[model samples]
Target: MKNLKPMLLEVNANPSMRIEHEKELSPGVFENVPSPVDEEVKVAVIRDTLRLVDPHKQKKKDRLDHDVSTAPEAGLPSLCLKQVFPKYAKQFNYLRLVDRVAALFIRFLGVKGTTKLGPTGFRTFIRNCKLSNSNFSMASVDILYIDITRRWNSVGIDHKESGMCWQAFVEAFFFLAQKKYKSLPLPEQVASLIDFCEYHLAVLDEKRLVCGRGIVERRNALVTCQTDGLQLTPAAHTPLLNRMATASKLADYRNHQY
Candidate 1:
């Protein structure tokens, strides 16, 4: 059995139905008898077969999609900034900016296979970017990076293997830009900083530019809050009802003939 290859013979779709067999009684008289033992055996076989097919069915909690509260760190499909940041989506061309930034990021880090960026590579990329007419100075950029790092650490983000996905990168960019220009509104500040970065990136050499490596041009699925707008019943109401029943002196009353 171990040396031979197993071949699939047939598949029974409805295997749990009870089967009846004809039992000959006297000369030609026949009676149909249902076999409960055969039915039970069939059910056991089906259950054991399913268990063998899916061995990880009991460990579903360890899967990636089990916890929807946290964001994915690595191996994420290409994402658009609009889906991740819908509030500022209509204000600026985040799609284009994300692509441009991703191209530059790939070139700087020489990234291959995956679009994830580590902390050290991200810091190097930020330092290399020359922002013109922007409020962010060298010192301010370092401070912003530190703040974002602390935020990632607080959320228990693992930067050792997969540093930051495309979504995280765009989120960090918006956070840093928003912090630097607090007086301006969200749309204005983000747009202004994007313009400055775009002008600088536009003049760089196009020979080493790599497109669609880590980031793509499409919007990924959004993660929505499952518990939003839920109204839970108050426990105080239950206590109030119990108190009313006790006040009426009906707590020990019993009707046996009803």
Candidate 2:
């Protein structure tokens, strides 16, 4: 059985004429689609892109700057934005921060009684946020790999529960994302977070942490498990930590030979 598409047509010809026309129209599969060629044409017209290699493409705009295939109608050129601006992207620390913030918001949604956030709820909330990009660089705010291991972002730990909420929230994110498929339409909160991070540099970075309640109160207790986790030092930091031993050996060899 084929369902007829109800058309809201303006009738100047008269009600009887409209009814007669409706009756004449066949109620079948062919009438429903109306155009197979249009659908096929659309499927075939999928965008094809060329990958140009240029380290300094952003310095100057050229004739090929605008992707003409996509748009000749609009005058503005399609800006050659890099997918992962490795030079400008931040480190895992920034991701950790984002994960934490996601956690805090997710928690509020799943709280049972007093609106307190939990790990699972925060995780679900993040699932709903629908972060579009698979690559993390789109979310960073610093000079890419500044080694968050340094003692730079530790200030202002007393203002709000932001750090704590973030910590738990991040856990939930990883939990759900490991082996699950979230629904289609992503939630506005996720998009909002991504948009906010993409535009505002300081809010995500500790150096320029947003100086307000909305930004500050969105925190969580800095869980001990989360600490030193994103530090990409080594499978074991201890073996690498013993660099002095190798240096001393070289020094001993030089001394003995002399």
Candidate 3:
């Protein structure tokens, strides 16, 4: 019998998105030095879609028609609100813009492959959440996190909130930031957890000379609450979402759950 060891899983953190800088490759593509994912645009698109269906209907397969009726009518197949919204629909045209010039500071520590949660090495990275704290595994999701992290840092978003920042984002949502090439903040980390959907999961739109359409301007300012008087604002109202989870919740979710 061939002594068989388990095979490692490979995750494509930096999937090839061929948009580059200065040197134009095609007629339509622009030369973006830095890229950031347009979180607002993503939110706008998703909000439009959710008008009809629950965006998080994971169990339901894509078979039924949830028509929104906005075309020639007769020939049009069943649709969701995603089809109706124009700005959101046009968003795909700017996939290249996801990596803005401001998104270059991120440092991606490459790992071999997606580490199995069962392994002892993943103790910290896979601790309370899906991964252990110290576990250094390379999954596709890490790429998204790297992108988003650098992008957010550029635009002045140090979000340390509950829903938008912690539970829905953090480790679970880091994959979106790991693309390494282009990154941006996402609108809805999970479906129901998000209330307002100005955009789905996109970076800012910096084309056509348009700046700050859907996003709330987040300057690099942290509201300092002294030793006592720190009034907390809700995450829904702010553009910051890069916060760590509550201590007890994090501890319970990671170290104590077992």
Strongest candidate by TM-score: 1
What does candidate 3's lDDT look like per residue over 146-243, in tens digits?
Answer: 45444544554544421112222333333423322133344322222121111221222233224543232332133233312344455443444433
Displacement of the residue 197 alpha carbon in candidate 2, Å: 13
How many Å off is the CA of 163 in candidate 2? 15
lDDT of each: 0.57, 0.40, 0.34
- Give candidate 2 regions above 4 Å deviation: 1-127, 130-165, 181-258
* Worst lDDT 10-window in candidate 1: 217-226
TM-score of each: 0.34, 0.17, 0.15
Q: How does candidate 2 score on lDDT? A: 0.40
Please give, for residues 167-243, the per-residue lDDT of candidate 2 as tens digits.
33344334334323344233334434545434443334444444455445544334433455645446567676688
Q: What is the RMSD of candidate 1?
A: 31.5
Ranking by TM-score: 1, 2, 3
What is the per-residue lDDT of model 1 for residues 31-113, given as tens digits with 9 covering 90 to 100? 98977776655555554455445533435656756654344423432221112345555665555566655665576555566
Candidate with better TM-score, 2 vs 3: 2
Ranked by lDDT from best down, the candidates are 1, 2, 3
